[model samples]
Target: MAEIQPVIEVCDLCKTYYMAGGLSQSVLKHISFTIYPGEFVAIMGHSGSGKSTLMNILGCLDRPTSGTYQLSGENVSDKDDEALAIVRGQKIGFVFQNFNLLMKRTIADNVSLPLIYQGVGDEERRQRAVEMLKKVGLEGYEDRLPSQISGGMQQRVAIARALINNPSIIFADEPTGNLDSKTSDEIMELFAKLNEHGITIVLVTHEDDVADYAKRMIKIMDGEKAYDGLRADYKENQGA
Candidate 1:
């Protein structure tokens, strides 16, 4: 059998911010990891732990000051802004704590927004949006405005939007932060289902319960990797 290629590869990743008056703060310190296709991984840390900064770089929304990030075998760490945008549009999907939908737009329109950037025709975009919505258990919701739905349903719509582009990986940041426990579980279940179908998911959260849904966990503390291993093992070690 042929060896499976990693969907995401990071090596000695480092990020720093230079503020005014010549003060600079290092955010990520030589972070290294690899994520294979179809893996469900959670990145966890407290506020100011650099997890969010790592997420930003992994999602292609920002670049690391040094080190390498290869997405689906493409070196993206040094890519220009326009090139990064193209990489994100082609290879990544993002779900945020806030649904980030246009309240006035119909659900289908929001889900199909990425396709619009790719210049897909209206009819095709609608069809694809409907398909993605159905995948997220929101069939027949295409015409409804975001305001008409419950928070969980709005999150489902966001997941549908993330899937619209057929991305190789999805980066979810605090995806269940705003929902109640029941609704958060539902959203996590939806992510699990998506992962079962071979979609790679990288979830970022501070909540242990939410992180429990993922098979593997990578914990960051004070700009360094604190742990990187199976979630079950992490929990066991914690309990020991």
Candidate 2:
């Protein structure tokens, strides 16, 4: 079998912000990681540890101050806003903490948003969106408003929206943050199923249980990677 190229590769990734009060703050410092196709990885860090900054860069929501990033072999470090938008919409599937659904639109409409931005025809977009919704177990609730669904259901809709375009990687930032433990477990199971079917998943989370769902755990501290290894290793060393 041929070796799979990394779906994403980062080298010396850095992000720094200048405070209004004349102080420079570095959120990510020389961070590096690679995500292979079909791998499930979790990024874990404490508050202010640069996990979100790393996520923003990974999702194309922001650019690194200095470093190199390649997504599916395309250089993404210095892309302008418009080009970045195209890459984000086409290559990255983002699942946020708050679900980010449009209140005025129904589930189906929300799921079709990325395709709409891509200039897909209305009929085809709706068809694909509805099919994705069914895949996420929302077959009959296509027309329901986001407010009408429970949190977990809303997340399911979000996941369907993320998958509508068949992206190369799904970037989930605190995806289960708002759910109860049981609901979180269910969501993890859903993510596992998706990974089983060959979708690469990158989850940003702080909860140990949530991180455990991924096959690998990457821990960061003070804007630098403190640990990067298999989840099973972390589990074995939990009490050490």
Candidate 3:
């Protein structure tokens, strides 16, 4: 009988960076949107389009200069770094284009790093890492070093690492930027499976093929929301 809550809500959000000459450049201009639970959304934009800045704010890695950002009902726009870090660790998972794995650590160790920061004990962390890796189809690759794996498998490890925290949302920024098309499709399929399990996913990508995997697409142009609609609507509206 009760209305479900939004996983993320952004209201009139704006971010500006001060320059060397007393100048300021805005990255997000009055951005407003809402993402509900179980949604697979893609934030699409080219370089300098402010999509990266928006991702930083959404993932609690940075704060907005104006307006409000509510993540799971908590106002995060003004949270200090420590507070934001806690929020991010507890509620969000991040996957970067570079895979961001430690080359020297085993895949299992890399996946366990977040739980370590969360104060999880060694045995539990290892167990959870194995579980997550299995989820990402890397069952036997746990003991392998990142350098020993193919680029695609390394990315799978990153995705597994992202899931080990059991976050409410996963924010993947250009997750397939380094992969070949065949491997990129595999990764996107993996993301789709995760989304089906009710974990909210919002990835940033400039490629149409990548964005098409998401149900919803929000196009950012010049630091503003150019379109927010279903992927088909976006395609039709954009004349794709």
lDDT of 1 at 104: 90
Inter-residue clash pairs, candidate 3: none
lDDT by residue for model 1 (1-240), tens = 999999999999999999999999999999999999999999999999999999999999999999999999999999999999888888999999998999999999999998887889999999999999989999999999999999999999999999999999999999999999999999999999999999999999999999999999999999999999999999999999
lDDT, candidate 1, residue 196?
A: 95
The candidate scoring highest on lDDT is 1
| Each prediction's TM-score versus the true structure | 0.99, 0.97, 0.98
Give Cα distance to truth, residue 148, candidate 2, Å: 1.4
Clashes of 3: 0
Question: In terms of lDDT, which candidate is stronger, 1 or 3?
Answer: 1
Candidate 3 ranges beyond 4 A from true positions: none
Model 2, position 167: C-alpha lDDT score? 97
How do the residues 1-240 of candidate 3 rate in per-residue lDDT, one tens digit apiece? 999999999999999999998999988999999999999999998899999999999999999999999999889888898999888889999999999999999999999998887899999999999999999999988898999999999999999988888898999999999999999999999999999999999999999999999999999999999999899887886795
lDDT of 1: 0.96
Error in Å for residue 100 of model 1: 0.4
Clashes of each: 0, 0, 0
Could you give me the TM-score of model 1 versus the true structure? Answer: 0.99
In model 2, which runs have C-alpha deviations exceeding 4 angstroms?
Answer: none
| Model 2 C-alpha lDDT per residue in residues 1-240, reported as the tens digit of each score | 988789999999999999888999998899888989999999999999999999999998899999999999999999999999999899999998999999999989999999988999999998998899888888989889999999999999999999998999999999999999898898989999999999999999999998988999889899999989998898899867
Clashes of 2: 0
